[model samples]
Target: MKKVVITGIGTVNSIAKNCEEFVKGLKDMKIGIDKITQFDTTDHKVKIAAEIKDFDPQKYLDKKTAKRYDRFLQLAIAASDEAIKDSGLENDGEWKENAAVIIGSGIGGFKTLYHEFHVMEKKGPKFVSPFLIPMMIADMASGVVSIKHQLKGPNFTTVSACASAVHSIISSVMLIKSGEVDVAITGGSEAVIDPMPIAAFANMTALSQRNDEPQKASRPFDKERDGFVMGEGAGVLVLESEEHAKARGAKIYGYIAGYGMTGDAYHISQTDPEGTGAARAIKNALDMAKIDPSEVDLINCHATSTPVGDKSEVRAIRNVFGKNATNPIMQSTKTLIGHSLGAAGAVELIASILESQNEFAHGMPNLDNPDEEMKDLNIPKETKNQRIDVVLKNSFGFGGHNASLIFVRD
Candidate 1:
């Protein structure tokens, strides 16, 4: 298997409009989650989210193109463009033909779906725009990106709930390992912070109702946390075989050491109580990396701040590393960015890579009272400067999809 390295990354999230801004957001612990401004939330229980401030599609897409594509696709294009620009492979001969893209999304275009459905109900299906189908489908992000950039390799989107983006990364790694492609652009995009998802998550009791203090609402590992706050954003990464990157003199951030994917075969929306599946995924990734559990310096957890979800993830950590897993200094990115649904995996993965590269680890914010089950773990209560050698990024989604990615410092 060839060594896969992350050569470039681009992101558009509630915290920052681009990857450089995103790094500042993580370092400063600037919370992007606040009151939802995209729609009226007067009747909704959950009124907060991590939304991109003053989102302007014109910055990334033309006005004519923007009218046809949904917000999610626009975000994908912006992030992908940034990544592609950063990679600097545009001039490399035959690269576009061999490059691949495998971005993911949990809900394709929620805004388009709900709005078009209403249009159909009121104005009839015949009046629906011809672009409705392309904008509403889940896989269009990768498709449109490949077409725009003239990439002809494997192109598709993974839709495994929150694990979608990590799964996409794993797919890219496998493709590179198999000599299927030399380079791949992959990550995730999600912009579903609207009435339907909010109402649905609220009905499922999966959203935070701490509307009074939206910034502090997404308090992962805090005992007082009720549920996860919805967030919207997009994240994209440029990956390539290490040999190819070195030959082209590409800037390398970190190496994709290994990846693991698993399924709980449990409930549709509930995680496996024992967390065996999540633990299995972590162990598998470590095994592939050929690194001992003790060698891992940090754990980027998928702690969504929900009662059962947080505890289950902690138990999974215990299963693999035992009671003293805190030696790795576990932390959750959701504490600041909230959960970005399908984009959560890629967004949090970016946090992990940046923290490792910057040699810092964050404490669980707003963790005044820790959950009893997670008390044994050594979660930081404040940001600290430390050496991070290897980091594990975890993403466990609804319907039992679990993915763990290992990145080692270059």
Candidate 2:
């Protein structure tokens, strides 16, 4: 099997527009959650979210093309453009034919779908836009990206709720390792911060109702944590086989050492109380990496600030790491950027890679005071400089999907 290395990374989130800025924000412990402003949330119980402010799609794509694609696809293209350019793969003689794209989204164009449905109900079915279907489907992001870059190799999308991005990235690594593609632009995007979706999630009690203190609402591992704050953004990475990267003189960020995935078979929207499936996924990833749990330096947890979800993840970590379970530095970036849903894994993975590159583990913002129940592990409250060689990222999603990825410094 060919070794797979991450050559480039890009992200557009509530915190930053690119990887450099994103890492800086993470290290600074900046929180991006704010009162919802994208739509009217007058009737919703939750009225806050982590929204990308003042983003101009025209900066990445032409106005004409930008109008046709949904916000999620626009964000994906913007991030992919940065990743491709950073990889130096856009050159005329580069491995264009051997490159592919795999981007995923949990709920693609929910805003578009909601708006179109309203238009059809009020203005009649004939008034609906003809581009509605293409604009709302989850796979269109990859399709548009492939066309934008003229990548003629394998291209598709994955959908697994919050685990969608990690699954897509893992699949990309497999493609390269199997010698089917030399390079792949892999990531995920989400733009579901609209009023209808927010209301729906709120009705289901899945979102935080701390409307007064939006910035401090997403307090992962804290006893006061109520629920996750919905966030909108995209994250993308340029992945290539180690041999191909070396031949092209590309700068490697890190290697995707291992990947593991499992299904809980317990609940559709809730995690198993014992975290049995999640622990298995973590063990599988470490086993594939041929490393012991003690070797993991840092973990970017998928604790979405929900009461049950946070504890479940902690239990899983303890089960896998055993004696060193509480020793590894762990932080939840979701406290700062809220939950990006489908894009959570990709965004968290980007943060983890940057943490390894900078040799710094960021503190969990707004989590300085955790309850005894949530304090079983060492949760750093301040960014600390450390030699981080290996990092693990965990992402569990709706429908019992669990995925883990291990990234090792190059």
Candidate 3:
């Protein structure tokens, strides 16, 4: 069987703008949620979010090229640049013709799209920006990454709401394992911190109204939690087959041993209360990895903090591991970075890889009181240092999408 491994990782998130800071932010338990500054929130009930700070696209592309892409595309390009540099791929023989780029986004170029629609409505199509169409498409991230990096393999976007990024990782692994591509620039990116999405989600009551305490708003397994706090950023990973990585002398962060994807088929916007689908997904991943539940020492859970979402995930964990489930160090990075939506899985995957390397798991903040349903799990409210061998990252998204990826410390 072909083995897949992560050769490099890059990120741009609310708490950190690069890979090093991202890992440190997670370890230090830094929360990035805050009042919205991208636009005024006076008239909005939900005024808080986790926005990327001090981002300048000039770092990735020249001004002329920057203007052609939107913020989401800019983030994708920057992260991809970092990942490629980190991999030191230039030293390897030419890879432009066989490498692939597979990036995902839940809402791509939302800011540009929203702005363009208003421009067209007010000033007509003649006045609308010509770059709107290309900048607003979700697949542009993958396309731009491929074009910029000169990678000529499979390139496309996978959209499954919050599960989008992780889905890309799974798909990338398959492509490499099947002898389709030797290298893949894969992950997710988003920049929908604008007013349009905030209002739409707020009206759906999918946002927390903790305008007074933004940092405490994304309380994932706590009874005090109301809803998720929106966040924006990009996470890009360089995945290569073990043979290719070893041949090129690339640094191996960890091994992508197995993955499982399943849909609830129950609801478009709601999770099955019984956690039937989530459990099956978890079981499928474990089976693929050929390990029992007890082997996994940590789980980066998909606790989005939504009322229904949190409970369903916990139930799924419990159903899969039963009493032994309490042994793993399970927690949510969302408690610190809010929900990055599509980019979340890749971001949290970074944390998982870091924990696998550092042999420690970060604690969950604002979780002073774990909900009764989640109290049984071994979610340390404080950071704990332990030798970790196997870690699983769960990403359950809207539309009943559930994806689980298993990584073994290698």
Identify the candidate with maximal TM-score. Answer: 2
- Identify the runs in model 3 with alpha carbons over 4 angstroms from their true place: 90-93
Q: Residue-wise lDDT of candidate 3 within 368-408, one digit each (tens)? A: 77889888788888888998889889998889999998998
- RMSD of every candidate to native, in Å, equals 1.2, 1.0, 1.1
Task: Determine which window of 10 residues in candidate 3 has minimal summed lDDT.
Answer: 87-96
**Local lDDT at 233 for model 3:** 83
Query: On TM-score, who's better, 2 or 3?
Result: 2
For all candidates, what are the clash counts? 0, 0, 0
What would the per-residue lDDT of candidate 1 be over residues 1-410, giving only the tens digit for each residue?
89999988888888888878877778788888889998999999889988888889888778999889998998899889888888887666588988999999999988998998889999998988889889989899998899878999999889999999999989999999899999999999999988999999999999999999998898888899899998888888999999999998898988989888999999999999889999999999989999888888899999999988988888888888874477788889888888988988888888888788888887776888898887767788888788898999999999999999899988
All models: lDDT? 0.88, 0.91, 0.89
Residue-level lDDT of model 2, residues 1-410, one tens digit each, is 99999998999999999888988998898899998888888888999999999999999899999998899999999899888898888875457776878998999988789989999999999999898999999999899998889888898999999999999999999999999999999999999999788988999899999999988899999888899999989999999999999998999998999989999999989999889999999999999999899899999999999989998999899899989998788989998898999999999999988888888988976885796765778888889889899999999999999999899999
Which consecutive 10 residues in model 2 have the weakest lDDT in total? 91-100
Q: Is candidate 1 or candidate 2 better by TM-score?
A: 2
Model 2, residue 253: what's the lDDT?
Answer: 91
Question: Estimated TM-score per prediction?
Answer: 0.98, 0.98, 0.98
Candidate 3, TM-score vs. the true structure? 0.98
